[model samples]
Target: MKKSIDYSIEHKKWLNKRRNKKISVTICQFAILIIFIALWEIAGSLGWINTFITSTPSRVLASIYNLYESGVLFYHIGITLLETILGFLIATILGTFIAIILWWSETLRKILDPYIVVLNSLPKIALGPLIIIWIGAGMQSIIAICVLILIIITIISMLNNFLECDKEKILLMRSMGANKFQILFKLILPSAIPGFISVLKINVGMSWVGTIIGEYLVSSAGLGYLIVYGSQVFKLDLVMASTILLCVLASIMYLLVSLLEKIVLKHR
Candidate 1:
């Protein structure tokens, strides 16, 4: 009973230490952001950098406020956010399904291996015009572009992960009269959970890239459109505000994914 109590106390102490470390890291992150912004505002005020081009933090805040007053801020944000979320979901689900199919078919995998490599190496931007032409310049085209950019990478990453499952354990399962599907369900997929999460993390970034690129090509209303318009009109403040908002949105999405990872790992 004494040993049990001692172990429990030690475990609680370790948890507290880890919690404190996380708090310190978070504080440092916010401190760096605050310092950077302070320096940036100071430099712009003192004329160390071209405020017209670089745009001061104050100017960005004012521009965002103007956008809010104009009532178009959320409209633009909603369009881009919707497109990004849709593209992200479609790409992740389709890519994962395709990866599973590829893993199940060795003959198909061998045949498509070269093609997959070529596609991965190809600059997806080059296909942007074609995608627009084929899909007709709208949300569909944007989502298609996002999926095209992400699906190949997802397939390759997930397929490799599935292949990397412990061969001896697989053999053991097979020796025990487990079928391919059984082995896959019982061993392979579960083992590849970490890899799937990693793929999801990567796809988060890729999804944003693809969506932005698509919007760059043909967008009437979005943060991308705002950026393009601001640059054309030399509204650097607007550009900076949009860019900052984009960063904030992406960071929020990433944090949500990290939270999901924590929950999954804890359960596992």
Candidate 2:
């Protein structure tokens, strides 16, 4: 009975600590946001800054409400989100496969390493025109650009992780008559989970960048298209609203990836 009471107290303490941490984070995020918005509103209202060029947060919020009322915000957001998801998924799968192949073949890895580096080093924006030409001006091009941006990063990250696997454990597996595939499944891939999550987190932002660039190059729809249109029309409020929405979406993606990492780490 005494042991049970101690365990309950310890559990309560853990819960209290977790709750406090969560509240602290929430307060910090909102505090920063509030400070920024207050400053912007003050500057604009006081005529210390050009509201026409740099709209206040209030203006942006109004634009968001206006866009929502017009029912077009969701349409643009959906297109961008779909493109991001598709491109991210394709890049992750392709990158993992390439990493696996390179891990299995030292000769192939050496031969391809330079090419991978070159591809990774190439500015993705430079490929915007080519991708639009190849995929045509639509969601396909956007997805393609996003994939191009993320694939190299994912491959490099996963390959590095795969190569960092414990050599002793690999050798032990081989001595135990484990096949190449078995070794990869049991050791290499498992060991690379943290790296994979890291890649996903990185690629989430990259995916947004690629999509926005692609949209800027050519697109009739999407948040990027909205940004371009807003800039052309000199509607700073619209631009700010689109930017804030993008931030919110990226945050959601990050939180999801973090949750995935937590689950993976728990299993580990």
Candidate 3:
């Protein structure tokens, strides 16, 4: 009875510590944001800084409200979000499959390893003209750009994870007559879940980058288009609003990946 009570007290203390830490971190983040915005607003209002270049929070809000009233705000957001989701899912799935294949065949891995490194090192923007020609200037081209940017990175990261997996465990499974498929499913994938989650976190920002760059190159709509158009017209407020929205969407996507990581960790 005493030991049970002691265990309960200890657990409660740990929980309290975790809760306090989380609250402090959240408060600090919001505090920093609020302080920065307050200073920016003051600077703009006092004529201490050029609002024409930097824009102020009020102007940014007004711009967002204007976009909202124009009925194209959601439309643009939806297009970019759709492209981001599609590209992220396709790249993750395709990358994982390719990584598994490489893990399975040493000869194939050796043959393709150098090529993969080279592709990863090459500037993706250099392929923009070719992409425009091949995919032909639309959402298709945008998504293709995103996939091209993400796939090589994913494959390289995942292959490294698979290679770093516990070799002794793999040997044990092999000794127990486990086939390649079984070993992959039971051991390799489970071990690589954390790495996959890490890559997902990174790819959230990457997807947005790809989509925006594509939109800059060619798009009738999207936050990226808004940003480009805003800059051309010297509408700094509109550019800032589009940028803030992009940051929010990217944060949400990253949070979803974090939630998935927590769930996976719990399950394991």
Which candidate number has the best TM-score? 3
Model 3 ranges with Cα > 4 A deviation:
1-26
Model 1 spans > 4 angstroms off: 1-28
Query: Candidate 1 lDDT, tens digit per residue, 102-137?
Result: 999999999999999999999888899998898798
Taking the tens digit of each residue's C-alpha lDDT, what string does model 2 give over 201-250? 89888888888888888899989999999999999899999999999999
How displaced is residue 223 in candidate 1, in Å?
Answer: 1.1
Error of 1 at 22 (Å): 7.1
For model 2 the TM-score comes to 0.89
Clashes of each: 0, 0, 0
Runs of candidate 2 with Cα error greater than 4 angstroms are 1-29
Better of 1 and 3 by lDDT: 3
Better of 2 and 3 by lDDT: 3
Question: Can you write out model 3's per-residue Cα lDDT over 1-268, one digit (the tens) per residue?
Answer: 3454656777878877989999999999999999999999999999999999999999999999998998888998999999889888899899999999999999999999789989999988779779999879999988988888999999999999999998899999999999999999999999999899999988888988888988899888889999999999999999999999999999999899999999988866
| Clash list (residue pairs), candidate 3 | none
